[model samples]
Target: MNLADIPLRPGGAELLPVRGVRARQAFDNRDWVAVEIPVALEFNGIAHAVMLATPTDLADFALGFALSEGILLARGELYGIEEEYGPEGITLKLEVASAAFARLKERRRSMAGRTGCGLCGTESLAHVSRALPALPPGPSLSKSAVARGMRELASLQVLQKVTGAVHAAAWCTAEGEALLVREDVGRHNALDKLVGALAKSTLAASTGFIAVTSRASFEMVQKTVAAGVPLLAAVSASTSMATAVAQETGLTLAGFVRGDDLVIYTHPGRLNGQPATA
Candidate 1:
């Protein structure tokens, strides 16, 4: 796939007037802020969840959410999607296959997800983790490659550069070259966007690692493993629960990616220090 053809930027930011103080000096100026609106998802006329997200790339968000959340086993289950814009928010109307809709009905749950909130309305501990295919051993990559991808992700985050409120998810190659990057106000939303984008792209997701700007969370690791990515690099620390998930799934998880240094939590073989996983 031609990388240039993929839509990278989530529309621009909004300039809002704000009063702020810097160095004990009060000043009034317009600041660029990320757009956050209620994005509702409806499958076969049934309401599923409502998420606060930036409005751009709703299509990717719709497809990505369904696959990552285990709503649809494959993209074919989603026949079509329509967007209905109301004064309150945007609703994504997804026309799914009967099998997919039936499955959704059986395991239905409602979630009014907040910004950066995952599993907000999970009813039970069992539903928190979904069964997915085990990931294969990933490429043997150097720590420098992971850092390179994370560093490149900084410049590629067009939305975050303007609005300090957003996070980014980037797909990087084995050599640590970032190819696809998606941004959102919520970290999970950004990863979902990237997962959706990867599903639609021709690139082989298994051959690369996913890098995120936010601290690693359980949902973040779950989504990355669900997408078949071998490694996950976070700009900050990893939680104990997230580390456990990575260990259980054989996913190489790395956190606190500052320059050349990163602490690998599990499946360290994906890095150059050890042999690659089989």
Candidate 2:
């Protein structure tokens, strides 16, 4: 799948305004563009979730959804994927192995029982804090790297710059360059898309830390762990449970990542320097 072809329409360009009076006009032209597309994730023949997102690198979205939801162990575990656009939404048929299908079914059943119904599963506080696998070990990033990553994150979000309605997830190298970026209306979906893209491209998941233009929540950390990434950076704050899960999972969670400032809740050692590439 060509990532280039996914975001079919060029939203706009990144040209700066002329100085003084032109800046005011720049503000006038700054209207958010809304692109709503339906993303249907189907496991085998059963549909899992239907999301409203901006149409972009969907293959990454599929891979990320599977891995983040614990549907697939790794990119290699995903057997085949096909994208078909229908009148209602874009359906992604992800073919998983039988073993994976069984696990997905079990997950759905568990979720159903928790909410007392398959259709209306409301996650309670207890259910929100789920078990996480051990985090992969990596090199510690320097303070400079973290600072650079946060500063560069905003520039990577193409959709958010246009729509102001999308959230973005970026993969920044240990040194500070923003590499892969994914944007969606849902922060989790954005992160999933980034994870999936990293798996499908030259992007490395283990070494560099991830940054998001949204709050760091428990589910966010869960997705990071599922990708085997060692560190996560967020522009906003995190919940208490999120910090707990990060500590337990051995992930370095950093929140409120702005220029020269960050709050480290767990595994500060991992953020000291860039992690070794896995």
Write one digit per residue (lDDT tens) for candidate 2, span 30-112: 33455655577888988877676666778888998788877787777789988887656578899998888988876662232
- Taking all chains together, each candidate's TM-score versus the true structure is 0.92, 0.81
Checking candidate 2 for backbone clashes, the offending pairs are 139-275, 139-276, 140-273, 140-274, 141-272, 141-273, 141-274, 142-273
Q: What do the candidate models score in CA lDDT, each in turn?
A: 0.86, 0.74
True-structure RMSD for candidate 2 = 6.8
- Candidate 1, residues 251-272, lDDT tens digits: the string is 8999999888899988888786
Best by lDDT: 1
Candidate 1 vs. true structure, TM-score = 0.92
* Global Cα lDDT for candidate 2: 0.74
**Model 1: pairs clashing at backbone N, Cα or C within 3 Å:** none
